[model samples]
Target: MSASIPQDVFSAEWLALREELDARSRSHRLTGLAVDWLDKRSAGAPYGIVDLGCGSGSNLGFLASRLPGPQRWRLVDHDAQLLVHARRRGALLRDRAGSRVALETHCRSLSPMDRELLADADLVVASALFDLMSRSWVESLVAACAGHGQALLLTLSVDGDWAFLDRHGARVEESEDIAVRTLFQTHQHRDKGLGPALGGEGPAVLASILLAAGFWVESDATPWHLTAGDATQRGLAEALVTGWHDAAIEETPTQAARLGAWRDRRLADIDAGELGVTVGHRDLFAWPAERG
Candidate 1:
């Protein structure tokens, strides 16, 4: 097994830029799965949720209004700074019934995520996190949810497809772009704290794992379809291009010049408002297969 990456840090700006698209792109089918689970459950008391690797509480912001109210959430993350912001944002969550939410924060790493952490949670939710996790980590999560009879929703796991389109809605033919994407996919498997990150394979791998663990898994494509009119999407696309460029260069230093040229062309197209980007992702919802 490979050693984990130390201290994964995501800038606040990066989180803010991508969150809206995340919210927009999340699959309604998966949301419906979770909602149906909530509705079927006995509503004798407030529902409890645990959000693993909750970055800035975007999951809460997107889900609070949809889930049953009188909810209590435990938002967990390794970053103290993000926890601070999540705490502030979590306190403001309200369900559709206009009831105030109770929120708590835990600053801890994902390793050794024990049953105690999830003992009282009705659901486990995480956004944009599964791709950075190892297969074992996801299996562990599935096992934990099964053992405790909890439901789970994991959103925005990358599916490793990126399509760039010209103004006429046709795919652009760029060999350099394809090369960079291939290299970036290779880079995605590098250790990112959870051991050998699954990257683009997350959704499929996790669905299989959940099914084997005896959970009813529901999945849908949650791709971000970005065009020139969406400023946030454009900013996110630019950031994504820059990050991929850097990662590709780091992965293949000798090809830095080629990746640089590819980056320039992508950015130029963005500037001309002629670029369309589609990033593939998947949203997944799983519940206990037994449903006792």
Candidate 2:
């Protein structure tokens, strides 16, 4: 695993892509899954929600829209700029529903140092952030959530696979794109960056973690397929695939030429509107150690 991943995975491009998608009124299916989780757990109680790693308020608005709970909401993230957006979302939520929802935010990257996160949240929530972490970090995070009796609801994790109509194109056995996943996965346990891979094993891995930590975890896989009309979806797909190929070449220059050709073909197809792109995502729900 590489020891140099930035705190925010993909840094600028991922955030930029998210903003563009947000402008298009994109709402991940995981948002509903999270609400469903709480609804079942409501068991006649008001539980708070702490959105861990809430970036750019993309999912926050979704949460506020669906789970209009009077309980506390703490939007936590290391990025101050992103938290600013979260605050704006809170205000918008207030304005739209005219409901006085309790809102608090903590600006800090994910780390063991943030004990307050574990100490306060009844639900430790994160979307699309688990796959970027390592095993050790995941363990610690899980333990903390368990310790706090906080339900962990992690959503939209990549399962080390992609699919389109043509499954052949999905697997890049002979391409540089193969190396990109390896490099990113390498960062999981490398520890200097995004920590270990909490989720490369996909939904099953998360289920195991939550179960072992004493939470009865339930999961619903959401196929986050993207077609041509969604420009941001198309752009993100292109970036991830191309970035993987580029990383592979960075490590092994021997396949540089062929990898370049593969990317050109794929990108060419995408540009020509000859290919279809589809992404798969899954959401996981688990209760606090005590609750289960």
Candidate 3:
């Protein structure tokens, strides 16, 4: 990660966006995947886990509840407000479990305050975060953890590439879906500072990193299909798509008209009750124990 990393992505506005856009159960499809990965990796040892960039602690303490035996669960985030909510959730978890796990919270960006804790972590985890960071940041962090003998499990990497079938795909002819994709992708990298990734293609790239770093990667997936006509899913898709579009246009003004056209068409398709998009995701990774 460079000195210029847009570390400000965790600012108040972005935190609010996460609360709004990330589905309830706080995170819809990825929750179960996260729990499964952590549970299987802990072996018989007590779980020492930290939910990095944990928003509102929604899934943090909840993941702790599923693990039997001793568990030390920590919730961390750069957002102060989110940490307040996470602390409350921690308190609630302590009440229920009688503090069997050391429930803790750290309120600072991982850029500085978290390196120490991360150095001591048994399993470092995140969902939907890798997609939002640059390669340098990820490689550096993974190296740090691997050096410390900790495993990293990250999920919900956006593959950026989307599949729209022959029928609907044909509807996008003339400059077609290509332009919109280019723009949306451009926008994503710029605003998110994901740096040169194919937005949705991030998981595959992360997998390659895990492998090269000597961690055995176990990849699994669950898809979230959103039909815009459905209000809940529609709003999320719209908010995300629109933000992406805006990012794309930030760099290329020529994309303005084309971006508008795509948004309208997609909107119409959804409103007409046929708009659909799949939010792709995959999980499972292990930093296997080093042999003697």
TM-scores for candidates 1 onward, in order: 0.94, 0.77, 0.74
- Candidate 1 lDDT score at position 36: 79
Note the Cα lDDT for every prediction shown: 0.80, 0.60, 0.57
lDDT of 3 by residue, 1-292 (tens): 1111123444444444444333331333334544554556636555677777776764464555654436676777767787887777666564224545667788776653246767456777776666566677667777777787776656545556543222242232336556666655554465343355335556777777777878766676644455435566555455555655565566677768977777677666655656655545565555654611
- Identify the runs in model 2 with alpha carbons over 4 angstroms from their true place: 1-13, 16-47, 94-98, 163-192, 228-232, 289-292
lDDT of 3: 0.57
Residue 257, model 2: Cα distance from true site in angstroms = 2.2
How many clashing pairs per prediction, in order? 1, 9, 7
Q: Is candidate 2 or candidate 3 better by TM-score?
A: 2
- Candidate RMSDs in Å, in order, are 3.1, 4.7, 5.4
